[model samples]
Target chain A: MRALDVDYMLGLLPILLGYVPLTLFMAVVGMAFALVLAALMAVERVVRIPVLDIFVRLFISFFRGTPLLVQLFLFYFGLPQMLSFLTTINGVTATIMGLTLHFSAYMAESIRAAILGVDRAQWEASLAVGMTQAQMMRRIILPQAARVAAPTLVNYFIDMVKSTSLAFTLGVTELMGAAQKEAAGSFLYFEAFLVVATIYWIMVEALSFGQRRLETFLNKAHAR
Target chain B: MISVQNLNKSFGATPVLQDISLDIQPGERVVVIGPSGTGKSTLLRCLNFLDTPDSGKITIGDLSVDAAHASRADILGLRRRTGFVFQNYALFANKTARQNITEALVTVKGMSRADADARADTILRETGLEARADAYPASLSGGQQQRVGIGRAMALDAELLLFDEPTSALDPEWVGEVLDLMRKLAESRQTMLIVTHEMQFAREIADRILFMDDGRIAEEGPPADLLDTPRDPRTRAFLRRVG
Candidate 1:
């Protein structure tokens, strides 16, 4: 076995860092899309709208039941084969679509629970004031629900960042893909993989710090 | 004036409110007293269509709704004519005291922000919550939060006010302050319907007392008649237990 090359690993660090933005971009954009979609799904689940509720339940079950990797393949490979219109979707787009849809299913349940977790009294109070359903939701319910859902959302974003590694399978040269290419050329898998792992660990640590800060801010009024 | 007729509500097989009917002249203060689960709260909630009775007709001023056929617009109009104070206060936990009072003014009544702010300030002062106007409900004492709840309801200037166990959640020391504020409302002759366990406060403030038992109005009379003279054995038993 070749001795681990320290210089080769250090040289590969910048190349790996170069791809961090793409990975972060995918996670951030995917998170934004997923949050909005999840909120809509959550509202649908809560309201139990006639035909739409059935569709939302099936969608959530399917996405949450399947693995992200398989979903990515379905979006990137299978869908293109079945639908000619989807042929233009590249690996990055496919990965984002998969990430958004899959993670939205999970986030929707969290958001629904958070919304439901708001005191029933709050709903009564808003309605007692003559607020329409939309006004009550916009002015009262969703704000409190958003605070309850924020920490979980941050955790999901962190998970999404880590999951971006799977994008390399779709031929997208994100952080993991860049590290893999460098490791293959240098013939030093251990060193290259260790660098990528440390970077991911540091990123998650940063998010955990942010999560703590957010919780404190949200809890400030309730805090003694 | 407010009137409810044949108000019936049930949860599955359990009837919560049964054939409840009552009338309140303008500015009458009516207090409902009953054991927990007797549907006193359910009755007040149905007046505002909050509980959505299985079958009933509610009339407030010019607006009326039949529970079985109540359109959304009718429910909205009925609610707009009445104010409800929840048992737990239920001031928006995320909003400051002032915002909680002003939210409905701007959103429902179409008041300008400045006018709403002014009205909120005046109501906060009236409730002795001016000093705590900027505080969130979570940070306020239970009495203070209930005062905000009262203030929010009062600011609406609705034709009638409904309160559900307003002081039940307050500490003993805090209960006196809330009752004091409510006493002031009674003295001012606000048309109010209140559900509470505070028998003394109810007797002191109510123009009439309604003793609800087992989802029906078992007995009702003027405060002195109902509290001092007992006609129904159930009412006598309930009073003895709570007294």
Candidate 2:
């Protein structure tokens, strides 16, 4: 009914911007842990060791099959009731744990596919030269796999930045939390939501620009 | 010297290399010529434990391993003594031409990076790939890539070189360049075993020629004798088809 409030949107911008660091911090830390976990999961999938392999498959399925929101609640609320140590974890820690586990399940498959996509000849050639399996993987296989997985991995990171918005539901005041409080008090839902959405748009676009640069850099050797 | 005795391999029930045996003296260049799928390539691959022979014994230089009971160390030792040149020039896609040669030198041989680079430079110069030392495999022409493959092998200074149709994957025009490099290696008296369809190159380079058929060595002799005279009907038929 009322025209969009420019003054309120401008005032809300700085307050919301203050929480951007928390959002970014959670995403970056979550992504770093997720990448390491995903790599281990991917290798386990590829090697298919007996018991551990089955466990990894189930872990991926459970995390990937469930909704991220429910997973966050389980970490923050459900696990605390059963596990005494988990009860000490704050809302922020719970959100990060949830993000890491959820994204790892998705990214593990991408990393595994990239690892498998490398030509079999590369494996043969590395072994033919007397390289130990570890040496070959460190020097040869993983670098090529990283190149193949780069674009997909970046998309996950971008999705992760947006995913951090869900952190507010866990009682941590990230960007979305700040936007919610400002809209509630001022009763300017439309203006506050638009500004918050715009902030996310800008953040994602910046990531996309970085992704394009990364893709070009990674693809330099492959270009004929 | 390199020797393989009682080499046996199979893909499921179909035998790929059946009781295959051969010996090459130091500085000997033995070329394997045969029809496709007859296991000429399989024989060369078995020497390095690539393709994992169902059973066999291979002795190269100071290392000896029996396929049936080979340990990880034994396979690694056997692979160290033999260099393999693949048909498709499987140079590392991530490394430069120079790094491709230097990788094993640093990792397997435990040489310093500085020392490996020096050796890689010499190998690149020998294979005429010094100009493209920084080029990735995707950017190089097939012939140039194969040349780098040869250079990588040459850098190892292994007791024997195994070539599995090194030029077969190249374009017709590019084939000559790879063959020419092999000729140069032969002239230097490198102990080499090559499997190829190029009869003329085989004749020019082999100290002894081996003709494989039905996963067995049907006949073997000096280049002129095997290529010119008929020892076995299968060998003759194979030569007639490919030659």
Query: Pick by lDDT: which candidate is best?
Result: 2
- Docking quality tier of model 2: medium
Overall lDDT per candidate, in order of appearance? 0.90, 0.91
Question: TM-score for every candidate vs. truth?
Answer: 0.92, 0.96
Least accurate 10 contiguous residues by lDDT in model 1 chain B: B44-53
DockQ of each: 0.60, 0.79
Candidate 1: CAPRI quality band:
medium
Q: Candidate 2, residues A180-205: lDDT per residue as tens digits?
A: 88889988999999999999999999
> What proportion of the true contacts does each candidate reproduce?
0.77, 0.82
Per-residue C-alpha lDDT of model 1 across residues A1-224, encoded as one tens digit per residue: 56777887788888888888898889989999999999989988887899999999999999999999999999998998999999999898898899999999999999999999999888888888888888888788888898899988898999999998999999999888888888788778899999999899988998899899988888765653
lDDT of 1 by residue, B1-243 (tens): 799999999999999999999999999999999888899988988888778889988899997788899998998898899988887888888888999999999999999999999999999989999999999887899999999999999999989999889998889989998998989988988999999998888888899999999999999999899999979999999999997
> Listing candidates in order, what is each one's chain A TM-score?
0.95, 0.97
Q: Pick the candidate with the highest TM-score.
A: 2
